[model samples]
Target: MDHAVVIGASMSGLLAAAALHRLFGRVTVLDRDTLPTVDAHRRGVAQSRHAHGLLAKGREVIDELLPGLSAELVAQGAIRGDLQRDARHIHGGHRLARGDSGLSGLLASRPLLEGQIRRRVSALPGVRVLADRIATGLLAQDGRVTGVRPADGEPIPADLVVDAGGRGSRTPFWLGELGYEPPREERVVIDVRYGTREFRRRPGDLDGDLVVIIAPTPEHPRGGVALALEDERWIVTMAGYGEGPGLALTEFADYAATLPVLDLHHLIRNAEPVGEPRSYRNPAGVRRCYERLSRFPEGLLVIGDAVCAFNPLYGQGMTVAALEAKVLLEAELRPQAFFRRIAKIVDAPWDITVGGDLKMPGVEGDPTPRMRMVNAYLERFHAAAAHDPELVLRFLRVTNLYDPPPSLMSPAALLKVLRGGAPRAVPVPA
Candidate 1:
């Protein structure tokens, strides 16, 4: 390919640029937001201000894409920890297993991680990060993309156009205008609101565990997550169905108090507040059924949130986007082959995010036999997790995209749940 245009210079766009640079002579990444010179969040990505998690699987993929990136992140203050061993979690009034499952996760602010990776990707031979630029629409001829139209400038010709504009992408509309059938979308209304704040990480927090997650069960629909980041700071995020208490520190305390786990409540009470609390709402989880489309435009591919957006609560968005980039890296970027591979890449995380949301009681989706069985099993599975570190490990493996969802339903796992019981309470932070 002579030229490739990637919309949205965020994580996914940057990754796509890195992948395309090898095949195309010139790769340009376009974004509307003024690119930050430092590690700071941008308006285009409002959720970056909230708590974000990088699963082990995603980190591994990044490492493969950019060698020594993980070491660089850790050197810059990313907290590296074994998923189950160093992190504490409680779900459905039960504690998860706490042993080394060989799964490792790196926790850092989204901006920091994105900044470091962007720098490396931009350093490549023919990659360009163009900021303050907008992709108004797609330029196509006879069902094949020919270029990109700018918001206030001339159109740029290209051999390929990758839509990485995320959930707010206009590709569907563009496809409609181009006389191609837009991919049908499947949605599950989660209506989740997130509140986040940064605090000073004192000597001992959450009894010295690097992270703590208080998951929201059907009975208790309020929950939050807190993690120790670099520079003696901690980031905490809480979720609710709708109408949060408020983002004020006091309001955050009130919301945390509602969760069955008191670790967050206690932390909210004692920590030195760094800034004003912020909250964002996610009305639903969306998956654009690109795989079902019989015909798609040539020289046009949609990746990342533009194709499927998962609930941020699972911290799977960036990870899924990275996986999609991996697919684009290996494939020839044909419509059917690419979409099918992308579907396979997202199926596990999408199912996990949507499946977990459906357990919230009000979210609507077809409760297929598999869904019902998984939900029913988790009730017992959570109780059993306290004693069986193996069960907790399995959950983490699936959640992190390290293993497929089917691994959780293995006969051995079911047997473990059958033999498990009530969990002990977590100790207060010393």
Candidate 2:
């Protein structure tokens, strides 16, 4: 390919450019929002200021795609902690036993992670990043995408155009304009709201735990996570499935007090608040079934949130995008073949996210018999994980995308879960 143009300077887009820089003569990445020069949040990404976790699989993939990236992040103040040992997971109202699972996650804000990756990808040869450029429409000829028309600039031609425009991507509309059918969409309404705040980090705040997650259970619909970020700060987010907590400081802290575990509440209660809280709401988990399309234009492709935008609560979006970018590295970049390949990548995480959401009431979905069985087993697994470090490792491995979900159903894992302890109440400070 002589010149390839990618829409939206997102994580997926940047990674796609990394994969294409070696194949194409020049790659141009365009975004509507002016890209940030510092580790500051941009206007485009709604969750930019929120806490972000780069799962173990995501970290490994990005590291391989851009050499020495993770190390640079840590050196720049990102926290690297063993997934099992340094993090406390309170799920099914059980604090999972901690052990060194050999899986490490890089904890940083979204701005830091995206900014670092953006810098590295921009430095690659023949890769140019252009900000404040809006892709108004697609330019197609002879059933193939020839280029993109920018709102404020002249049309730029290309051999291929990749849309990483995220959840609000206009590819469907563009396809419809070209006399083609749009892909069918599958959506699960979650109505999840997030109230996030930053706080001054103090030594021994979490008692050496670098991250704490209070996952909502069937009995409790509220969830919260506090992660240690760079600059000696902690970004804490309190979320709810339907009616989330208020973003005001007092209300946010009050909601945290209602969590099954008091650790998150105590830490934020004692620490000095860094700034006013910010809020975000995700109405649903949407997946555009582009792979199901009978016909697609050549010289065009879609990746990342443009294809599937999951519930941000699971923290699977970035990881899955990385995996999709890895697929592009090996595929021929044909729209049909590329979409088909990424569908396989989307299946697992989609199931995981949707399955977990269905466990809560009011989330609209008819669970399969298998989903019900797996969810029931997971409750038991979480309860058991509190007593068995091996069980914790098994579950974390699956969630991290290092192992298949079936691994959790193995006879050995089943036996371990069967002999585990019951869920107990987490003690709160008086």
Candidate 3:
């Protein structure tokens, strides 16, 4: 293979570049924004300031890509805590039971995590970063992608093209222009809006376990907060649904005051804000059915938000992206088949994200009966997770994208739902 060109140098793009570098001679990552040298937010990644947690699976993938990356993050003040024991989780006004699962995770800002990955990936041989470059269209010949064209320059040629351009990608348009029908799309509109504020933790604060309070709603909205990134820094976010108004600082404080779990609110009230409140509005969930396309071009692939963008509130994007990169590597390195195997590998994470998004009311998409069933089961699972510690761990593992969604319906989980009384049936997985 000559070289693989990856569009967008965000988390997904960086991971794709790493995978491609291992398979091909060279990899080039093109991004419209100039990434910062330090751990600072950028315009392209609007969700950077919001609460971001690296689930167990995502952490594992990052470690594989860059060994000791997790330890480095921890050394830089990222908190590594047991998901159940050290994290307070409230769902639908109920406190989720803490499980003894050795399932732990890194709590850091999106910028911090992305910056770490960028620094490591940039140091790798056979990889180059092209900042301040926008991908204008695909370079295709005989219906297969040849490379990418930037907005103000000549086309850059490559043997493979990976679209990690994110939710706003123009891949569909380019594909359609090439006479390849665009893939089927599923969309879910939650009308979710978010406002995030960072705070400097006071002395004696953050000594207790960190907390995540999930307030759900169709009209009034849902929100959450947690200690993230640097020590003594908290990233608090408030989200509203439907026609609900954006959250102001005063409004955020008022909403935090009403959480069923009062610790988050109390912490916020006493703490000082590190920056002004930033808000983001997401109108819908999008899943492009690339695998369903009758004739997907060879030497081309789509990953991350470019393939399937979900509600960030779920925190599934990074984990799903990491898993996709694993799939890409497996397919590329295998001897017998490549593109054929690639399609199947991307299916798991795609279904997980799209299926969950279809659950939200007012979401736009063809929600087949199977999708509805999956949503129903997850609702029961969430409700059961509140009281059952074993169930909570399983739920965490699944949500963290470590185990497949089918793990939720395993015999262990089923027995917990069947047998009442404290709801502990299986030992938590390490």
Candidate 4:
């Protein structure tokens, strides 16, 4: 392709630009926000103030696309830790046993992570990052996208166009305007809300642990995560399903104390807050079934949250976007084939995200029999993981996208679960 224009300059857009740079003569990425020159938040991404966990697979793929990127993040103050060893995880109302799982995870505020990747991608041979430009619509001829029409400027022409805009993307509406059928969509209302604050990190916080994740359960619908980010600070995010954590500092700390585990609360109780607390509300998880669209425009494709926006709790969004960029690097630029490929990439994480949400009584979804069976097995698995470090490794591997869900049902894994700890009396919401 002579030129490929990608809309949005966020993490997904930058990755798409990097991938297209390898195949196209010139790759341009456009975003409405005048992106920051430093590790600072932009008005475009309010969620950047919240916690962001770069799963292991995501870190690996991003580093591959922009070599030595992980080291760059860590050197800039991002924390790198073994997923199981340096972190504490509480799920299914039980604290999972910690061990060296060898899966490496990266933790940095969303702004820093996105800023570093944007810096590296902008340095690519054929990549360009254009800021403060709003993509109003796509320009098309002969049922193929030909360029992008910005809000206030002349149309920027391109041989190919990719939509990497996050949840707010307007690609479907653009498709409808072009006389193409909009992709079918699947949505599960989660009503997730978040409260986050940054705190000064000391030497012995959480007894030297780098990360702590306390997952919500049926009985207690609240969850929390604290990560040691760059700049010697800790970013803590507390969340819940319906009535989530409040934005007030007192409310945030009080909500943390309600979690099933006290590690998150303990870390924040004495730590001094660095800034005003921030909050975000995600009402639902959405997936546009682009792969099922019988017809799509040539010279156009969609990636990232434009295609699927999962529940943030699973920390799957960035990893899924990075995987799609990798697929784009290798696949031919056929829209149908491309969507089909990315659909498979979205399946695992989508399932994991929705599955976790559906476990709560307040989330609206009809669980399939298989879902029920899997959830039941997972409850047992989580209980076993508390006493068996091997089960913890297996579960972490799956959650980190390193292993398939079915791997947990393997004979060896089943043996470990069967012979491990007995299930405790887990409370169920009546």
Off by over 4 Å in 4: 421-430
Question: Residue-wise lDDT of candidate 1 within 1-430, one digit each (tens)?
Answer: 7999999997999888878888899999999999899998889999998888888888998887788999999999888898888998898788776898788789898889999988998898888898999998889887789999999788999999999999999999998889888889989998898889999999767778888888888888777899888788889999876544478888888888988888888986988989777879999999999999998899999999999988888888888888888887798788788999989988988877777788786677667767767777777778888788988988888888878977866888866776664443322111
For the record, the alpha-carbon RMSD of candidate 3 to the native fold, in angstroms, is: 4.2
Which sequence of candidate numbers ranks them by TM-score, best first?
4, 2, 1, 3
- TM-score for each candidate, following the candidate numbering: 0.95, 0.96, 0.88, 0.97
Candidate 2 at 196: error in angstroms? 0.6
> What's model 4's TM-score?
0.97
Q: For model 3, what is the error of residue 243's alpha carbon versus the real structure, in angstroms, after optimal superposition?
A: 4.9
Better candidate by lDDT, 1 or 3 = 1
lDDT, candidate 4, 1-430, per-residue tens = 6999999997889999988998999999999998889879999887888999899999999988999999998888888889898999999888999889989988888888898899899999988999999999999999889999999989999999999889899999999999999999999999999888899999988888999999999899999899998888999998899878877777778888899988987888788889888889999999999999998999899999999999998888999999999998888889999999999889988998888889887999888767777787788788888988888998988888888888888888776776664653322222
Cα error, residue 259 of model 4, in Å, equals: 0.7
Model 1 residue 146 distance off true place after TM-score fit, in angstroms? 1.3
Model 1, position 316, has a per-residue lDDT of 88
Give a tens-digit lDDT track for model 2, residues 56-82.
Answer: 999999988898999999999998999
lDDT of 3 by residue, 1-430 (tens): 8798999998999988877888888999999998898989999998887777677888988788778999988888787888888777765455779867797788888887898899888988989988999999888888678889899889999898888899998888987888888877867776777778888866566566764657453222455767655767788886655533235656778777655566667777777888777888888777777766667677678888887787777777887788777776766533124434544545565576566555545556666777666655555666677788888888777777667777887887866654542433333322
Q: In candidate 1, which residue ranges exceed 4 Å CA deviation?
A: 421-430
